[model samples]
Target: MTCSPPAAPGPPEPPEDAAVTTETVTEPVSTPRERRGWYFYDWAASAYNTTVTTVFLGPYLTSIAEKAAGCAEEGQTCADLHPLGIPVAPGSFFAYALSLSVFAQVLVLPIVGAYADRSWHKKRLLAWLTAFGAGTTLAMLFVTGDRYLLGGALLVVSNILFGAAETVYYSYLPQISDPDERDAVSSRGWAIGYLGGGLLLLFNVIAVLAGDSLGWSTAEIARWSIVSAGAWWAVFAVYAIRPLRDRPPVETSRSRSVFYAFNQLGRTLRELGSLRLTLFFLIAYLVYNDGIQTVITLSATYATEELKLEQTALVPTILMIQFLAFGGALLLGAVARRIGAWKAVLASLVLWAVVLVAAYFVPARAPLQFVALGAAIGLVLGGSQALSRSLFSQLIPAGKEAEYYGIYQISDRGTSWLGPLLFGLAYQLTDSYRISIVSLIVFFVVGFFLLLAVPMRRAILAAGNEPPRLL
Candidate 1:
């Protein structure tokens, strides 16, 4: 299928001079080169998602936290941290770090997203945020032997920048795609990102394993992994900046300054009341995605701590999930075409709830638990997230795609806080990982009902026809 570029705003300046200067001008559709370049950003960015956020860095950071808090000793294994210090416990630091990152994301993502939308240099902003995130991730190398504060600080920076970069990245999507092709283009990008992320994560795992076998310190191996993540980010990001063309900033009157941007933002917020479906979907996404994210973040700790899985088993399990996610994303895209994006999303959410229930019942056997959880997550993770992106894309106003997507990012980030907090709270109150796992099902159930209420066709039409606003 082919997509035409959106109609040029305001009828092409009335053809400039209608007299002898009859030079014909054609507006270019987004080219294959530009589309590939745009997709490469996902490829570049996914290294962070797979290696640092999902598979490697969390475990590594938890190790650092354990050591720093004196709950574990060099070359000696220890139990997972408690939910909070709570009068001397092992894993308190882990809970603290997780909570801190969640809190920071909620506070920072919306404002940063709003600023990125109002500003002209989104690519540049993405670059800076990505670099900062990478650098902070790299700084984890220095967090050897119980440096909890340093490790926590690095994680805080990494998480903040990660969220900030994502806000900008999602906002950029509609700016560079025609409406007709957005779904296919977005799906393809997601598929490519999963593949790329899996490949890079495999390489990082090899490095860490080799480093460990060579009698290198865990700290040294971890440092190398951190550096690799940064390198991967920097290298692939080049594609995004090189072939992409920036949209010109909207001209504002002299009366409209930086403060005016805030006024425009306020206006947009007020206008949001009319975009009820969009608002509803945003609320729904917040509830469910937070559950997804919390599961992703905490699964490794659960495997290692509760199931007694070694790093050998845990890392490979994660790598398997990454590779499976590649196929899962593409497969879900096809499923979306068949059943509609909303139904597809609902299906994935239902699957997730079932998976959580199954996880609760899985015996204490590490391999069995890993296999069950891994397979279930692999099926739903990519589908739910990719469909959500496309679904939200359909809901946004046409020329105001960036502005509305910024609001979408705000919803995404804000919704992220609840699940992790719930997981941590469940763990604290019940001291049962099984209960914690089961509790996340509420998010999926609530989000599914809310999503069911959204009018997909209306959203698609609104996104295609709405006028651009300053916000």
Candidate 2:
């Protein structure tokens, strides 16, 4: 494997007789303040992941959708109904919401990513998307019992903004870290993110418990959680805005606009055949990440529905995983130093496969399953995600980081439905949750083998040689 040279300094200056004046240049170093600002975006955005996506909002929305579908005349009980054109069932509303969110993410993230790259205001674009997501999350507070449509609409909007912000965030990685320090910087960002997200989640958990003691209704607690998520997002985003500098826009033809970004994206897709290893890595990532996302999205639901775990117990368990993931991400960074980032990711995939198999056998034993699964997931989740970000940052060409990362976001969000579809099928077919857990292992195994075949260093070199394109 051949490594590419680090980015060179500016060209030598012309002699005094030179006719044209040269443009002023800035040093390439990423300052500590700027790096901290970048990491704070992760901290700000992760509150949504912890409080809304992973823990509180999903279950609460599902419950509301179900109750709203309940009979009005009976005032006792009613059959479950599915909204969003998904199949009618008690849990199906959440499934529909997840699928819709994933679908929108697949469509919107790449386009926005490409557009952001062509424009000078990447951070400004990110701020807008963040605010959109935060506002939508706060809007969820108004959804009461039987307000399934309202809740679903809010989720769709929030999730779309969330996914778009992520594309912007990942694209910024290359700008913020020198080639030599990429992995270390990326790892530190993930570590800080986990710590921030976990700490906030701990506070939310306490708030929920305290609300119960204070005789707050379920709706009141849910509303408080939703409002707090938005506040958290807005507060932390201030740091990101203060220190990060935006790259100046590259000059283009008069025809270029947001729509033209898609044309550039088309060119990038056409050229993908020249970057064989990157293409392969994308395929592999799509498969395995599907499983990873499914696990994260569905774990709470599985615990509540299958294991009969209470919301109170499940929330704390999820919080524990968040804290544990901080250590896990740091350890994996060390592992990456010992081995390569690619190999460390492979090891994590292998661990995931093993953990999924274990999940199959231990579903009935709630306590042991909770502890075991949480630890196993915590061990691999941060490492796999953070390292993948660093590795991909290396592969993108020097000037087109945002454009390529947009394509990367497509892969991240596009095939997200497969795992959930499979899980739903397994549950429907066998009426058994165990089979659903077992089915995800295939994604990890297949992705691992595919990853083994890709040559990372070669891909980086090829990407370096390519002309910058928005996609």
Candidate 3:
């Protein structure tokens, strides 16, 4: 983390996006302790993303949904579990849950962020959302028997809260650091998140491994592992919540009411369209990030369903990916320093395409083959996401980073709906996981072409910043 001081303490201010046409406002540098605090939130929250959402929940929830639907396990012929006259397959249950959360996020986050920028309660809001989300995650422990809807409700609620909290938390970035230091700080934070996630995952692996020896069922271990994730999220979050304080809530005339927040959002959207390169970049990020997120979200499900990998093999591989991504993010940062963040991201996108294609053809029962595919994914996962954030930060017009990033997260969650929806639809239609896995390559390909059309120099110039040093 960088060792600079924080922004001068001041009242909250309205977004000055009109100045995007003129000059950029320079940012005050942030302290290392504050940056570390920021990084810890990522570290804290990642346990859920790592253990529950990625490694355990997919298979565990699939099993619950499958059994509820009167099937032994989710497979090519698993029965569809319908609720309210709509068929919900085990393979698609979590996907639909995530898509539903994304829908809620797109509606809720921008408004929350606008309010956060205008209010003094940013940290308070972040804490409340984190606790609420983590509490919902903890509720997963009671999702026993055929109560899949209860489980799905908790997961979807948790996912929605996670997105809302992140909108406020991410707004803190530009507040904490200069654009020049953002790449390194962001990369290190990703590395730290990976480390935290990997360590927690390691403990979960041990729990699962020891369950049989301790006379505990595998399902019991899975439930405890999920419960542990919620505890971890709630505990580590205190690190950021403690030392960090929010800028005094600026109750400007436009910010004094909910109606004004919506109007501000409307203006931001209208003005956003005029910013050509930034708009294109968001579109490209939405497409490519959809592919990235889908792979991360579904990798466990795909392995369990298509590859037939046991939990013992799957958890260890996930642990390996978590640790490897730590190094991968840092390594990619160095490579970006030598080349450029954008080009490095492009290279990672190519690797993502390769991983998807390989997943389509890889042997279903081969543990080593799945591990190999996972290693390749780990190599690109952290770097691609970290660099994308750092790169986007550089293009944000000053005084409007929070407002624009609200849109950024919206785009992020919005496109997320597409990739998983497509994945689930493909599976629903064909009962073929291979077809679903390979289908994501279209996102990377389309994103690559669209990203190529973005002119970085003009984008930076329009944002009134020096052309990005990291890219």
Q: Count the backbone clashes (under 3 Å) in each candidate.
A: 6, 1, 2
What are the per-model C-alpha RMSD values against the true structure? Answer: 6.0, 6.2, 4.2
Question: Which residues of candidate 1, in runs, are more than 4 Å off?
Answer: 1-28, 73-92, 217-219, 250-263, 410-415, 462-471
Q: What global local distance difference test value does model 2 have? A: 0.73
Q: In terms of TM-score, which candidate is stronger, 2 or 3?
A: 3
Candidate 3 lDDT for residue 459: 86
Compared with the true structure, what per-residue lDDT tens digits does model 3 show for residues 1-471?
Answer: 111112223223424332321132244556678888999888998898898878888788878888787886434466778877798887799888878878777877777767666665678878998999899999999998878888888887888787777777777776776666677778888899899989999999998888888998878888889989999999999986776655533233434466777777787777778887888898999889999888888888999888888899999999999999999999998888888888989999999999999999988889998899889988998998888888887777665666677777764522267888999999999989999999999999999988888887788788766675657
Cα error, residue 155 of model 3, in Å, equals 1.3
lDDT of 2 by residue, 1-471 (tens): 011111123234433211121111112457889899888888887788777777776677767766776643324564657454545555556656667777776667777877887665778888898888888888887888678788878877887788788888887787776665677778878877888888888887887777778898755676677778878887898777668877643323355477787787787677676777778888888888888878887777677667777767777888888888888888998888777788899999999998888777765537756877888888888888888888888777555677777667654522266787788777766767778878889999898998888877777777763211111
Give all TM-scores, in the order shown.
0.85, 0.88, 0.92
Clashing pairs in 1: 67-146, 68-146, 81-90, 81-91, 82-91, 82-92
Q: Candidate 1, which ten residues in sequence have the lowest lDDT sum?
A: 18-27
Candidate order by TM-score, highest to lowest?
3, 2, 1
Model 2 C-alpha RMSD to native: 6.2
User: What tens digits encode model 1's per-residue C-alpha lDDT throughout 1-471?
Assistant: 011122233346643432112111112256778888878888887887677756666667667767655556555655544334443233434545656775776556655655655454667878888888877877776777666677767777777777777777776566655445555667788888877888887886776577666887655665676667777877888767578665543322244344655566676666667777677778888778877877786777677666667666777788888778878888888887766777888889999888888877766655866786897788778877887887787676533445566556543422255676677677767768778878988988998888888776765565444321110
Error of 1 at 380 (Å): 1.8
Off by over 4 Å in 2: 1-28, 71-86, 250-256, 411-415, 465-471
